[model samples]
Target: MLAANIRTQLEAYLQKLEQPIELAASLDDGAKSAELRELLREIASLSPKITLREDGADARKPSFTVGAAGQAARVAFAGIPMGHEFTSLVLALLQAGGYPPKVDAATIEQIRNLKGELRFETFISLSCHNCPDVVQALNLMAVLNPGVTSTMIDGALFQGEVESRKIMAVPTVFVNGEAFGQGRMTLEEILAKVDTGAAAREAEKIGAKEAFDVLVVGGGPAGAAAAIYAARKGIRTGVVAERFGGQVLDTMGIENLISIPQTDGPKLARALEAHVAEYEVDVMNLQRAEALEPAGDDGLARVKLAGGATLKARTVILATGARWREMNVPGEREYRGAGVAYCPHCDGPLFKGKRVAVIGGGNSGVEAAIDLAGVVAHVTLLEFDGKLRADAVLQAKLKSLPNVSVIVNAQTTEVTGDGGKMSGLVFKDRVSGEEKQLELEGVFVQIGLLPNTDWLKGTVALSPRGEIEVDARGQTSVPGVFAAGDATTTPYKQIVIAMGEGAKASLSAFDHLIRSSAPAAQPEKLAA
Candidate 1:
């Protein structure tokens, strides 16, 4: 149940309910069901507008639905929505009670105008920080649209269902009984997937926009900094990103951010977004850049998008950041969501009581092994190097775990699976040229990161490793076009470094703009 302070907060929040809400429970004689009943009772006691009923028809026991009184419930939870999902429960209650959500008006109208019925079931682990976004997004859609229904199912609580579906990742979403997507996704991304013509519409709208003074090609720490800095200079700034937070959303704990003692990825990402919002930067989320063109004779650089949209700007900053490096072994891609995972903190709970392997011997790998050892039955860490490259303290902690075993000089050959899910993997002993196999239910890859600069291959100067070549001032080989963050030749891939580089790139772009002989062109204003 909730603590004393949380109860007080919940009581205050319930005051915002504009309509009476009902909590219908489908329960069994299990301990989880008892706990859920207590939680429901506590919630019902907080507000006069709330009612709890034990009679329910859901096939999944220990489940419940929240909706406006006398209305068909569209939002349900098959497990106790605690931990990261606690906020999701609160939001579901409020939204179901006719309390308006914090989404933009355009998005609200789009959800309401959706065509067909959508039944969404999201499987998640309570410990996963990324799960709440997916859960809350679906809940919002269900609340806004009568044709949509969403269910948040705890994979750990429903072990049989998870195993039967061969789900090995948190936040795996199923729509209409078929796999929809897996991983951290925003509401816009989900809408894009379901709305077939959305991309074309967005592309047309974006193509009609005027050129920006400074265009940031990412929305991570670097791109956020660039946008803020450019906007502060009274320039028309814009940001295009696949996701607003980039890889930082997938990150778990971030303790090394200066001045702040501790914070997590999602928390930090939200802060970054809020900070950027303080300026006049136009942030276009869920937009991917496909290609980059240097400044033409008209004094503007062009960035093409995968959705057929092209944006022109006086200056462009490439801060696309990086992504997790995957093991190139066979079956890795096929069983990615089923058994092969990259984020240990997000997917570790799904492999509880099952044997797993952590690939790599670096800090991330050792750290993953140490974390997985606490939840999994056993952890086998395979390192391609001759010795562990983790910090001394991390190595010490990893060595202390009895259930974790380390294998140095081992290269992952192939991820062995049962055609549907991963059952094990094969590795080669580099020293002896011998092959070894270990039976495991999950494989957590923690090798390293690959720069997200594949699109800029021949467009910009790049290093041998595919990183954009940037000078001291963050200026790339092309004039008026700069690069920053993990996608560039930055020595360190730290968040702090990326922010500084972004600022520098923006300043350099501004300098380039001022030094040009051509006069600044007045942008065409569009009707709002």
Candidate 2:
């Protein structure tokens, strides 16, 4: 059954609909089908302009074709779209009912002018917060371009297809039957994959020149910030990232970014790219930096990308960022996308009214518990330490929530799950030597972060924990090279902190450029 609050929200959105939308559902006879049909009926009933037709047992599983009256079905939702994906369903209905997309004109133009057929099949879980962004983006693109069509497949219901595709994560997108990317992605990123010719043309333009005044590695918040700051200085700046937004793409709700009260990870990531786009930064996305070579006195620092393209720069700023620490328990890997999730923000909604557990007693774990408590029915936070390590303020906030409970001196022993999905978690009391099992649908692991500095092992001075060693000004051990964000020895790993560090690192790199023997150029004019 739909939550009252969510139903209210959906009704409000439906009231704004100007055109009629037709939803043709192909459902088999089962409890899952019955539930999905009821949910659709509820949604259709809310809006006088919406219509639902039962196609009956035509598909192997529950599927629906959504479009305006007399129009070809341009969008499809396969499986139940609940949890975080409810938003996607609502958005799809809105767009089908004559609501325009919110994409930038540039991206829209790109989509409008796209050639060839693009079939995007996005496999997603109802609980995944990140999946909605990608799904909505692709859905909008499909609406904008006749050449493109997208289907949102519920990974949970379509277990056979999920297994056949070997989808290990939510929001696993396939472009033309090939895996494009897993996790959250922006509209621009999706377009880049569909328009291969455009990407190659852009790459050829960048490959013609190999040197830059400042080359900022990574595309997360720190790297994006660094590239923008460096490019604003009128220098030839370039950025190489396997994907823009780095670890920030995996994040969900960001409330402490200053000024902005609250923003999700995908929105913030798009904003970061939008800000960088205002400048002349040469952004090379989908490129990985395999190795880094320090400048030999007179020569520029060389960065070797996985594509064999070598970028030479007078100054290099490392902002690769970090990844989440895994618990390494049994079934943790077996059921990654199934039930064991590391991001509470992305997957919390999926477990609505269901019991869940949060591992680790740090600020992240406490914050996750506090957040999940609001969305889920109950939250059990397990800490390995004798006492929680989170700040007193956070601890107090977590204590104030009635739905959340904290368990200390407990070590997660195993993530017990059915072959297809997670069922519960097994834990052991460190001191009491007692084992316990918590029946929960989801588990969020917020133990800690591991910096993405493994590739820079011998090239730079790294801390014992593998973070790049940097001074206050963001200067690394090597001259003309700087590091910032979670990848560095920065104490805190907040978004605002990473942005500040990125700016500092860019300024430091600029200072090094001016003091060095490189050609002197006016600050107002960009290097040619």
Candidate 3:
């Protein structure tokens, strides 16, 4: 109910008193002047809310409180919030107009395990409009939860405060006195980190609903993509995964994806998972799905969690990506990152100009051989089969590299390494029945990949290898069920492809919803 000019009025009152009076000189001045000063003082006392304090060299500390509820909900700007940030800051404060952030079902679920507070402070230049959707998104997050605050401090106006915090960037953010986020954000990422704050504070009040709509069983590219799209589409999505990001998260760099020239898998996954908050997707980290069941006519399905909770979904999008098949040989597990690697695209740079080996001669193996030959001093390609299963074009490419030599009909029974890194491999020639050893700095295994659809049972159609079977549009055999990314029998497992599939499935599900309602299937006529 306050007017917009109140700040101007208060500032006018304070500025008028800027005149100085020396303590030494007593201006036991005129009665008229004294009477006027007393009248102004009495008028100020009418409010009974104004107080004087010293801060800066003048010892001036200018803080004024007027809300009936006191200063419970405060937007303290140590510096001015100007430029594009001005509107965002005002909107954020108005949205979170009450104390703490608002708490919603989705927001509460993530913060149920929270036991502490997170104070987030974002430093921004008045000019960083490229910052993106986080400011408003963060305000919405605070509105849904308690004890979470989002503030955008204009670093330029408050140089002293900025210097005290050692701020070096335009949009640097801090959570609990440490950095939470920087640069542009899409709301969900900000919520993700803040929810982590809520989770830490209210660790015991999570609630009764543990289930979710889209139970993304894994946390790889596909699962993360599915969660993001489903949440955005207003689906009551929940993610149950052993981890947040799957094997791709372990990757060092991803250059093949579009838009971004290069990014580490873990960083990308973190950003993507944060994007899930756009529509309130619930995430159950460190948990796994154990089973699934058809919901019959409801067109919905039920997924059983490892912790015994059941999730219901009108439509299920299977995005539980795939992983590399392991060697299971001695020293293989022990020296994985050191010497044994699954994806050359992830770790090839570490072996530059040094001897390396590519295990298996399938498409993946050949591709790895070709990629590694560009960086390594030598590459020995091994295959247990009689010949390479790679395409003729790729096979020619691999052979063209002088550093890469292919060995067919080879079997590796053991691996030996040092200092948690691999150094050599012992193999047996399957055709000649002779054993041989190769010394190398790195080894890229590309035998095959296993889809993570083992727990899906026979509730849905699946490929022979247990990959979920879905149509080109990511639809499963069931009407409401959909599948996407690597879990499905899709040809490619790239990040962009997974995200594209996720969005397509969400749109398809929305279309299906528009149909099958009580009003029947009446299509609206187009406007002339």
Which prediction has the highest TM-score against the true structure? Answer: 1
Clashes of each: 0, 2, 27
**In model 3, where do residues sit more than 4 Å from their true spots?**
1-207, 210-214, 252-264, 296-300, 328-339, 343-356, 361-379, 385-405, 416-424, 430-433, 439-442, 512-528
* Candidate 3 lDDT by residue in tens digits, 1-528: 113474455434434332221111111245533443343333244333333121212111121111112234322333333445545543443343332343456654554444456566666655444332455455454444456555555554445665566443445677778867654554545555544544333223222454344556676777777777666655467766666766665455589888889876656877876776555777766556778786566555777666555666666667777778887788887777556777575356446567988998987789889977887799999898899999999998887878888888899887887655678999998878899999987788888778888887677789998888888777888677777777888777678887788677766655555564411112331000
- Each model's TM-score, in the order given? 0.97, 0.76, 0.51
Error of 3 at 150 (Å): 28
* Candidate 2: Cα lDDT at 367: 90
Model 1 Cα shift for residue 1 (angstroms):
2.8
TM-score, cand. 3 vs. native: 0.51
Top-down TM-score ranking: 1, 2, 3
Can you write out model 2's per-residue Cα lDDT over 248-318, one digit (the tens) per residue?
A: 77776788889999987767987998999999888888877889999986668988776667788899999
- Look at candidate 1 and tell me the lDDT of residue 316: 93
Worst 10 residues of 2 by lDDT: 519-528
Each model's lDDT: 0.92, 0.84, 0.61
lDDT of 3 at 241: 69
Candidate 1 lDDT by residue in tens digits, 1-528? 789999999999999999999999999999999999999999999999999999998989899999999999999999999999999999999999888899889999999999898999999999999999999999999999999999999999999999888888989999999999999888999999998989889999999888988999999999999998888777788999999988899888899999998999998999999999998888888889999988888888899999899999989999999998988879999899889999888899999999999998999999999989999999999999899999999999998899999999999999988789999999999999999999999999999999999998888989998999999999989998998899988898999999999999998887777677432433222101
Query: What's the residue-level lDDT of 215 in candidate 1?
Result: 94
Candidate 2 versus truth, CA RMSD in Å, comes to 5.7
